[model samples]
Target: MYDSLWKALKKLPLLPRRLNYAKAPALRFLDLPEDIVYEIVHHLDIRSLCNLSLTCRQLYLSLLIPHLHQQKLPDPFREIHLNGDNCTAAIPALRLLLYDSPIKAFTWRAGHDPRTLVREVEQLRRLIARMSAIEYLELDFSNNWPANEFRHGHENGYWAWVRLATNLLHVVAQRCRVVVVTNHYQVLVPWVTFIGGVPYNLDPPLLARMCAEWRASAGEAEALGSTKLMKSPSKISLSHPDNAPASATFPQPFPPEKGSTVYATRRLIVNDPGLFQRSLFGEWALDWVSNMPLTHLVIHQGRMRLPLLRQLRLPRLTSLVISHG
Candidate 1:
């Protein structure tokens, strides 16, 4: 009877115990001053920082500080890489980063589908256009083809591929300091120190046209040679010289000669051996080299003829890599 009575008492609601229980204190990261919060954030890696930002609006705004981003994130937080699938998904993150951080270099690796590749390229172009500063941009199409496949023809869709590549290059060159198009490899470093295999099956005619436009525009600027006119920000123009007034001319496709006040340096890499072959090495090849401001040149699976080398105007050429064709 005593045991039953004790059990009945135990089953009764316990107001005293419920009154004694207390809730745990909440973490108040936002309670900290902005400076202190940034200091704490400094120790976080990119992933951690991104997670922290998602916690609340207060943390998001605090992390957007430019100095904090530069100090906490990898130096030159500018270099970004995107694979085919992630390109669309990564845009929101990219825009958030660009809200305070500057993007200097970007690389996009395309997938097999030609339509998707074109869309991704267009998207990348739009993203680049928003940035106030962009130096190096690389569009890699090598992922579309297998490693062993290097032959050029309709079977590989060489013409369509070249046309797209050329168009992309033209768009990138307008904004970026160095534009790199790779056919079958990944280059992690920037253009200044690029080390990799050569690009293949490049269209000579399109290259020739690109070279001709650059040469003609550069020549026109040189002929005008007005230091005051070139320096004036309000009057600066990059139009084709023929389109400009005779009194002023467009700036060179690449920077003008170094040491001069108006000079800016640029680099290019053409890995296409077919364009440099003996039969194809004509005025187009000469024009391409003579106009380019390439500081480093890498040609794979092809020989660099002495005459073509002679035609190069890359006084700034520091590194040259040539592999067996």
Candidate 2:
């Protein structure tokens, strides 16, 4: 009953009225220890953090502390999430953190504005320059790369992504846990649309190089110390059905044998018609992960490819899981 009450209070939307409830015995009844409160906030969901952050300045301060901020993060807050539409407000907060703090991870997505979309890549170069402590990183961009809005279309071309990718890879080569670059609705576009397109999506070579560097660095880290397991791309998918067809699945090989188990999902869910098996960004994801020395594969949703069983390979294979493959 006490745990339930505490959880309820933690999950409840905090308002000025509820802020007064900090003194209420319902919160104090359980008499949670100071360490435990910090643990709860650090390990709970982002919504829980939002609720607690609103409860009092102390709780807000607790959640942001460097040590506690790196605790066992819940599902919603664990991975960096930046929906395409929310990028504007999200970018500023991200910038402030990038400029002022050594963030553990940062997620990026282009918002609704066309200019912002065009300028985002440049913005990324600046952000990546300052955020050296980032361990986990995910970069998802909007497909709204407007043709008319381009400076002879060169300003918004794949070369722009090359600059962004170069800066990102240069800094991230030091200490990065996981990095994801994707387009939100990539699966919806047809393949031929990219033919003779001047490599006009993300810079595949840059990504390949980044993956190669990450593999090498992680190797050195393991060789020098006791290696930990690494897992991302889980088997269970939240967006797809339990019995989805095999053609729709593209599970990766087992994660590399280092770091804690991590689940990685780097694909798009297409709601529109004419959804292609591949992405507008090409097969960069599978190709990218195939190069990564990750282990313990886990995925939440999106189509799966079978080439992983044949063409692609991750030699570090260990535990393979498919919750909704």
Candidate 3:
């Protein structure tokens, strides 16, 4: 009788009890300022940060996109690889990624179209200007210069490349510690050598133009009393002796008297074999390197003769590498 009564009583509600439940609102993670959000995620690893970015679009922009250059991450951030296809489209993102970012290296791979080379270089120049001081910059222009192709319509392309090359070097010398510039093209026609000892695309005229622009800029820097990286009594005079243009006399090599300049660029690399040919600008190249405060120098697939090597007098040069054919 007691068990039956207990069971029956459990099935029946004798009195209704009053209960209270509280419901708090959800936290808005994106409402915080950018700096504060960065602080909160400072301890997060790259994977965790990536996961958090997927939670919302705003978080994706704030966390993942801007933090692409985080030092803790792998080479994707520390080393930026760019080609002709992604150069212009990646500017805005790169601006955010490069600002105050510890990016150490940059590489640009160009295509074979001579017409688009200059325009692409302009875009590249813009991106480089935004980057912080970096360790290495590699510009591979091998495809842009084909020895036997586009012979009739390549002169304008050559000049455009020369001007842009000059400007790019100026920007790089200040921002990069080491730069490797390569333009490897095989000579297809033996008779082409009769023109200038090299192909038409990379002839003495183009080299002279590049050297002249460098001298012009150095002369301007001298006139402005900016002797930081360029100071030589025999440095290209802005005013020619006979009132002729400076470019007229730019073909001549520098005097044997050596002068040095302190530049942020500590190392240089050239990968073109015919670039410093004696018939080309071998002496000019020697004089140029002897003047720079370079700690390291490398010339790959070059024709630097033993006599030319003897002429190299770099007081601060600690390492040298030469690769001949």
Candidate 4:
């Protein structure tokens, strides 16, 4: 039967000659075994792998394999710094790199001019809006000329620049889990140390007034015995540059209330002794610290009242460091 079938096929005029195996086109890279292709792709850096994925649908689909994709991607734990002369021009590249990356920490340096710095911050805001994985952000004003002036109480367009910085922080905080404002190269420092520009001579009087007002208000509220009307304790601290012993206290005892949401800071460092001495406009310099999510706290050369310390709610705090002057 096989012989008859072969003979009948040979009689057909449309039948072509059998092709030689040796003349067949060489096997392409895509034709290779999937395991071999994946092995080759695994050695590629993230940028190269991303490019390869864009070449065709097949390569793109291959990269979607759970194990291979995880191996080729960059580690999100490492902190990414954006600074230098070309940072403005590099925004697009930065955005591309961070778009899908699990990077959680970012540091941005604001340059010298206010206008140029605003533009840079705007670009960054756009970038952060698209990156939901970012948990920490630091805005460095150490390079900004006006920031230095403000820190020393020189006051040459300092207020305007500070307002810009504050506005930027407010916006960034909405997207970031931890937002930091710093003039030094270091990322996190005590709230007082960040406000070093306040006048030294006025520190004592300003602190005295704040303490008096706080106490008087507390007494009045306590007399009424209205729990709903009572104000939550504010974390306040103050010190003099001259090393004069300055302190403030609340008239009422403070205890951690039940059911209150506590935000934990991962790291807090207070290096300046005179940080909380003066009022930041009408507010205590370090009043903002109470609202932060504090996990690790370090106080160096600064002082905290016993009442304020007790009132602080740091449920996630694991490390505490304190040093006296």
Which candidate ranks first by lDDT, i.e. highest?
Answer: 3
lDDT of 1 by residue, 285-318 (tens): 4444444455655555443355656655677788
Give one digit per residue, the lDDT tens place, for model 4 in 19-135: 767776789889999899889977866557657766887776565433332433233234556664544544543454434443456767665443465567667766665554445
Off by over 4 Å in 1: 1-77, 91-104, 144-164, 177-179, 184-265, 274-292, 301-311
Considering summed lDDT, which 10 consecutive residues are worst modelled in model 4? 222-231
The numbered model that scores best in TM-score is 3
Candidate 3 Cα misplacement greater than 4 A, ranges = 1-77, 91-98, 144-153, 185-262, 278-288, 309-312
Estimate the Cα RMSD of every predicted model relative to the unseen true structure.
Answer: 16.0, 22.1, 16.9, 17.3
Worst 10 residues of 1 by lDDT: 225-234
lDDT of predicted model 2: 0.41
Clashes of 4: 6
- Residue runs of model 2 more than 4 Å from their true location after superposition: 1-102, 140-175, 179-182, 187-287, 300-304, 317-325
Steric clash pairs (candidate 1): 142-183, 301-325
Q: Order the numbered candidates by TM-score, best leading.
A: 3, 1, 4, 2
Per-residue alpha-carbon lDDT of model 3 for 1-325, expressed as tens digits?
Answer: 9999999999997786767667787868777787889998888765567678778877867775556444322344577777656554443345444346535667787755545655677767766766656566777666544444545443333333433554465556546666667665322111122122222233344334433443334323311112232322223333433566655663343433443433456667766665555632445556555655677776654443556677777889887766552
* Backbone clashes in model 4, listed as residue pairs: 263-293, 264-293, 264-294, 265-293, 265-294, 265-295
